[model samples]
Target: MTTHFWLNETRPARQAGAPENRVYVRQYGNGRAILLAVHGFGRSGARMERLGLQLGDQFTTLAPDLPYHGKTEWYDDRYTPREFSRILQQLLDRYPDRPVFLMGHSLGGRYLSSCLAGLEHPDLRDLVLVAPDGAGGRYTNWIDTLPSMLVRPLARISERPRSILRLSGWLSKRGIINRYSAEYLKSNLNDRPFRRRIAGTLRSVLKFPPRAEAFERALQRHAMVCTVFVGDRDPLLHHDRLQSIYGPLPSVALHHYSGSHWLPERLLGEYYRNSLLTTVP
Candidate 1:
């Protein structure tokens, strides 16, 4: 995997004297068709490297670390889906000549949907969404709302090492949070700067949840071949809701797998293979 950075001047400025927005991208393969894969929240582009590698033979897979995630510099007051989508649009512009395929998981899917909704790109040929969030709604549960409400205040306590350690330990012991989630949270707590940025991003997501109508509009207008894969047991998204949201669009096809939110490697690879062979002209 090779890392590259591009400075985006089109992104709206949130603060004075903020450095130019720099997008971090990981590239795989050297094929003519381009696959722009977007990772989910709390995850980096590295997570999608395997998917990229699997599809690399036929397509140049590019996974970008969205703002405030991975190496991408955070410039916005809050990381809104619209802003993330804009950044993706800018990234896609770099490869104007290549046939582009958009693939996103979870939050990335929401941003991808938002970005595709407003833009008309001739190079964009296909879209692949894996257990995406925001299909049903962004603020459908307290899990999303409570944290957003407390993000600012929690950032203060998150900066205190002892406070975070104690809270994490308590939450883990009571099974209020899974061990992996707890550890991830603890790591964020120790990193004060990252914590602040994450808090702001959370607040922004809560304030501006993805609109289903927007996604429907994008799907209708673009008329690109779209493949949507959702795990039957995905806790983050419901299959019925996804079907409801995407069923009406003739260009979109939805598939359901027997698994959880995370798609198994074998199944994912198979889908990618089918998508690459069938969609590429």
Candidate 2:
């Protein structure tokens, strides 16, 4: 593995969930506050390393791969946004005193949305959600592609019917439905190996439909300093609803960029675009 591919531990030391699981982490900076970087569907922890590294100069960064993503082990359990939120709450509990700042991209952004909607963590200070899902219920509503329509029903079936989950996995791996599903996120992930890891994880998230009621409860409970950023041209989210969601955040801010949903990767390393990531008021 390359230096970037290998995980680095500095603060609490690194740990993995299981033997087959790949939960590599890289930490940066001297600040006491923690920014938990979460990547979108199909993406691993490594993709957010640059953001961690960039923001680490000012704050302590903890970026980890979600289960069944990146280097993590795959399981039969339905990994919804609520479950991911619980995992994050646990992370906050593990680290005390330091204010937790959550940053997520794409599906990771969607998880942040659910967390923000339902989070009750008193320690959570702020949230930076990039291209978040469920804002206008974009990911839930998007049907431009046939895969989007098929994936939701497939996810719903995976819960009770054991045989379907297997079939879902089979179709996902065979490249019939998988390639079509990833057309939107290809630009952000340049590496072929990285792309496969991301695509596979996304397949898992797609199979498990989000629980809207639970997500709304979480939204009402948590009130943190939040900011939602979206690409102006991104077709997934409805612009009108995005505007509606922006009006009520008590401690929240909204930012619009010229890029697509994969703004982080597309804008990474470029000084101008990088500036925008930190250009919040």
Candidate 3:
């Protein structure tokens, strides 16, 4: 049987009260270890599927669509912490004995950090962050850290064309958001439906600030093997920012690529080592 393929699925919530917990995942491969891959902002699970495809020989990748971006249904007033935990549990529960690895890209890094903050699975062995967020990057701004009551109104700023354009422009000018993010916002807010979708993603982003200290502490507690892959020219993911987040732990490897925000997939393949994996944690 060919284990190297892709599968798209939307699994329903098992718990009766958790109807909002349905999750959509794009899975690839059937290797011994399981990889839970998270994608960047303004992207679906398909983006992470690209990286997962490269590591499929050694790892089976489970990339889930974050709420507001894909098939996942979420229209809540707030995107609470551990919001996806149940769905994650549902996915990983199938492979009880497999050593699980975590990988996140850009904004997905923050989601990964939030996931690890309370997840207690010992089989989790490694974390691969590619141009990830929550490394003390520019995104942890006051606007995003607002109280829940205030955040809904803040996210609604994206509802109107003028307000969102001005906001993105202001964020770019203040360096609170990346150039790509600013550009994406400017170009995509024309349609009302897309604007609504953008509002929800913005709300989710606002709800989860940088959990760096919490994430780092969790990594130490779990003794997780961590490797951060960054592009040298990626303005959003700088060397100093990453060093600040992972420098205390000498075990963490920081690999810098000679490129831009989009890392070369071939280089990522070069660094994947199954030797680093232990027997189910």
Candidate 4:
């Protein structure tokens, strides 16, 4: 059995100074630092808890539910990437001496950038993202482009069950998810709590303003070693756009693999140690 620690939402965002985000953290290894893992949209921190186990020999790991997602069961009326960044900062303030390795997937990657901006920690050394989001046009083929730009908007306006079913239908037809391993695909629906959280998260993004200023600020003041990983077959985001946003960083390196968007699940341990953990100095 794996040992786990639950961090309640008692951090500052809440009126009582309680953590606004609920975290499920598992400790591993003997290292002095921690890896803060954030999952992409429709996913919960619990899904990524294995990262801590995989890297436990080298560092402690904290996989936390983002606002409006998972155990947090909460949402900021005016949510933005900066809100997530500030929240992470509050959590890190408690462990300043230990180097923090920030790892995020997809949307989580976009928010992770905010968390790292303008922060100067001696031990804070590496930033890694897998199919990390931010750069536009990441998924460029006609099939992906049309849906991302058109269908996605329509789906947002569509009724819940109808939208989800429609989206599911579209996914089925495109065979976009065919490459994902059966095991990974199975896990997508295993966590009941996560399924509920996805509703609010999607709603927040559709309504919340995109804080481009905050994103730019973080990207520009970036002082950490950054590495990016994306699969060749992942639709919805293109590599060129991703590089356009993050490629400017002299310390950042981009790697491409022959996998899909869900590569993190199919190659969990491999991804943890390679694409993510490798950047940690």
lDDT of residue 142 for candidate 4: 25
Give per-residue CA lDDT, model 2, range 1-281, as digits (tens).
11222322212213454232224554554446667778765567777666556655555666667665666543433355555555566566657776667787767776666556545556666567677765553554443234766655654443333444455456557643353334433333445444444344444555434444554455446644556777887766667776676655555577788877774643532432243355422
Return the number of clashes found in candidate 2: 10
Comparing 1 and 2 by lDDT, which wins?
A: 1
Number of clashing pairs, model 3?
0
Task: Return the lDDT, model 3, position 125.
Answer: 77
lDDT of 3 by residue, 120-234 (tens): 6757778888887766444434355446786677578878889879877886788767777688777888976568776776677655666566766888888886788878787
C-alpha lDDT values of all predictions: 0.69, 0.55, 0.68, 0.57
- Predicted candidate 4 versus true structure: per-residue lDDT over 157-254, tens digit per residue: 33344445556556556764333322232455345444444444444443322244555555446555666787888765766767676666566677
TM-scores of all predicted structures = 0.77, 0.60, 0.81, 0.65
Consecutive 10-residue window with the lowest summed lDDT within model 4: 136-145
Q: Which stretches of candidate 4 lie over 4 Å from their true place?
A: 1-30, 75-78, 118-120, 136-159, 163-199, 206-222, 263-281
Candidate 3 accuracy as TM-score: 0.81
* Model 4, position 186: C-alpha lDDT score: 41
Compose the digit string of candidate 1's lDDT tens values, residues 61-109: 8888877788877665566556666777776778888788888888777
Candidate 3: clashing pairs of residues: none
